[model samples]
Target: MSVSSVSVDLYSEKQLQQLVEEISLRFFDKPFRHRAFFNRRLRTTGGRYHLQSHDIDFNPKVLEKHGMEELIGVVKHELCHYHLHLEKRGYQHKDRDFKELLKQTGGSRYVQPLTERKVSYHYYQCQDCGGMIRRQRRVNVSRYVCGSCRGRLVQVTKND
Candidate 1:
């Protein structure tokens, strides 16, 4: 999928629930009556549906990295759990109803890992002379120097 910059209006909690309801209607002939929201603190998992609260929490990283389509699939996956549990059908990953709903709805079997997401970098520079310095690992200015002028390379603040 194509990558896009972070967007704030991606989906509201109400809009997400509506999306889930629409997907359920389109594919499963059911309605999704639950809460859905973006959970920015979610790290590795794409989405989670709570049985007790009947709320779906999504990973914001999915929108940041994989964009809209991937986010939709994640919502569908959570809807699988939401609908099945409410209907008194099997609602867990290993249950028959859950698996069947997931397959029929074309939902992702599991949330993708966040490791593929883009990461910001920390950059350092030399102040004494005009030079470029880059390091994933921070460099100690006391030991590092600009080779041309034999001038010390002061550690400039990082970009990230």
Candidate 2:
């Protein structure tokens, strides 16, 4: 049996702006007067709201990898920051108002991972303490020592 892959068309920047505007008006009952566009440079974050410019920059990987629903959730999350900040209310993630607004709008608190980390970890063992340490890069045994017991470290193995 063969599985056919369906191609999904992503939205352009102009369409993204329009979508943001519509979501803002419908959910928040407020108009998004600033610009919204896809930002290809965004790596881990789903979307970012500019404090000074009030513009929203979205990671295209959200829609590309997740789909339209996840992208909308990201838009809502950014809009929470946008609207609250503009209103002179609490806009930061830790603020009560921001949390309330985010919950009411059904915004996503965290986005799915866009890409997997391909980093390999180097495992080390402390001679004195028998503690294990994991590092992405190799640590020099001559220079670095274990903090717990000041023991010399020996490389155990490398794992992906």
Candidate 3:
């Protein structure tokens, strides 16, 4: 189902909870008894299922970037984990039960990687050759020199 046909904001925490419950019933023939909510802090993953609390957390970006269909897919993926865990079955991603249930429920095997990683690079420029370098670790300009020309290096910019 497309969000375009629905007037309400589908990514709201309450709406997510209702959607999860509905999907759980429809696909798994089981009720989702735990809470479901959007978690802005989820960066690389589309959703998370907490074993201790039986709660599900979804990444809002799934709805924003891929729309309701993808969000529903993620919900189904988490539900696979949720139900399997509650039933004392194999719930880990690498387990046979997880793979089988995920396939049976039409859940995504893996969430698409985020378009961008949350990484920052320190950039430097060679004074002599004008060559540039990018590194995850900050370089000491006084100690490190350009490899090509052995020229002094200067900080350029920090890129996100």
Candidate 4:
């Protein structure tokens, strides 16, 4: 399904659980007996499958940024780990069974890397002392003087 059509903004933990269960049955031909929920704390990972608890944790960012298709791929990838581990098959990323199952189910091999937010800093340099200064917000060069030598601060670069 298209990411835009999934309406993930309103999705809750219950819906996430149901989606995982549905995907498990549809793609793996097995039932997902464990729980699945959105983990807002997940930063870089798309999803994580707990080996001990058998529960799945999904990064909400996946749905927010990548959409439903990417979320489903992540679900499938976790499911591959879930089912394979339970069945005593190779479940690690380096395992043959894991690779084959991931390929067969069309699961994402890796989480799509999140775009890092860049902070633009205004750069200033002292005209007399040559001291460098960086500020998040623009500073009035005429009013603000260099901290080191109290010299006139000149705008060196707008952003970096």
Candidate 5:
């Protein structure tokens, strides 16, 4: 079978919920009362913790591509958000408490790319610092200047 058509059905929805509950109790010393299930719609993020319903949705691609270890790390990360938010602590990523708890729990800070999407970039060079900048969309060189050294930017031709 082609790699693109390959699929992984490692766990059922009920099993996913059980796993989340187990991880939450083990790592956070709390219970996961809400639902946890696979979300096929998730694209870039490994998992998402909802604020309204208190549910956690996981991207199956994490297990499919990276395996169980990475999936556990992602579960820990989501549990960090779930528990902290429920306790009315700093649950957001920018908060210090979230960072500390994430560190303590050994949660993943970033997930590997789930799928490859081809994006064409416009390359630019700074005249002063000689630094290169890559942008997915065409940048307005006339209006925008280099973030560092405040230098004029010139577009560079690159065939990707």
Candidate 6:
């Protein structure tokens, strides 16, 4: 397989944006002004809002492991801080503005934990004959491939 192989997770970028916008309106009664993007480097954090650029960063792993509902909760949590601070209200976790907004909007008080991670599959290939395989998880396909000519690579049996 060439380095060009691209694997896209289930969620699309547009979907994330829609979720952010929806949460902003539903919770703060205000629009989210900055962009939201997945930060691949993010590991422990679910989401972060930059005070300087006013942009929102989210860990894609949060959505990949969890579901949409969990992602929405994270967005709501971030928006609580974003809106309150922009309004010149205390937005820190200790501040009254932050506490009030969180309760009133029913946003999460703390970051939710991501779901237990499952190993991701990006397809597979055989070394001997350039045979390609697809799988949901890594497999020792070496013992399982083209029975004829022993052309190592076997197309993954699963639709995924």
Task: List, in order, the clash count of every candidate structure.
Answer: 0, 0, 0, 0, 0, 1
Question: Tens digit of lDDT per residue, candidate 1, span 1-160?
Answer: 1123324356676666666667777777877666678788888889888878998888878877777778878878888888888889999889988988788878888666777566655455566676777666777778877766767776566555
Best by TM-score: 2
The 10-residue segment of model 1 with minimum total lDDT is: 1-10
Q: What's the CA RMSD for each of the models?
A: 9.1, 5.8, 4.0, 6.6, 7.1, 14.8
Candidate 3 backbone clash number: 0
In candidate 3, which residue ranges exceed 4 Å CA deviation?
1-10, 118-160
TM-score of each: 0.62, 0.80, 0.70, 0.70, 0.72, 0.62
What would the per-residue lDDT of candidate 2 be over residues 89-149, giving only the tens digit for each residue? Answer: 9999999999999999999999999989787889999999999999988899999999899
Those runs of model 2 whose alpha carbons end farther than 4 Å from true positions after fitting are: 1-8, 125-134, 143-160
What is the per-residue lDDT of model 5 for residues 1-160, given as tens digits with 9 covering 90 to 100?
2222324558788778877887877788888899999999999999999999999999999999998778888999999999899889999999999999999999999998999988889999999999999999998999999999889999999887
The prediction achieving the highest lDDT against the true structure is 2
Superior by lDDT: candidate 2 or candidate 5 = 2
- Residue 110, candidate 5: Cα error in Å is 0.8
The lDDT of model 6 is 0.70
Better of 5 and 6 by lDDT: 5
Instruction: Please report, in order, the local distance difference test score of every candidate based on alpha carbons.
Output: 0.75, 0.90, 0.86, 0.88, 0.89, 0.70
Q: Clash number for model 1?
A: 0
Clashing pairs in 5: none
Please, what's the RMSD in Å of model 6? 14.8
Ranking by lDDT: 2, 5, 4, 3, 1, 6
lDDT winner between candidates 1 and 4: 4
Candidate 1 global lDDT = 0.75
Model 6 residue 84 CA deviation in Å: 1.1
Per-residue C-alpha lDDT of model 4 across residues 3-119, encoded as one tens digit per residue: 334675747998888888888888899999989998889999999999999999999888888888888899999999999999999999999999999999999998787568678
Q: What's the CA error at residue 15 for candidate 4, in Å?
A: 0.5
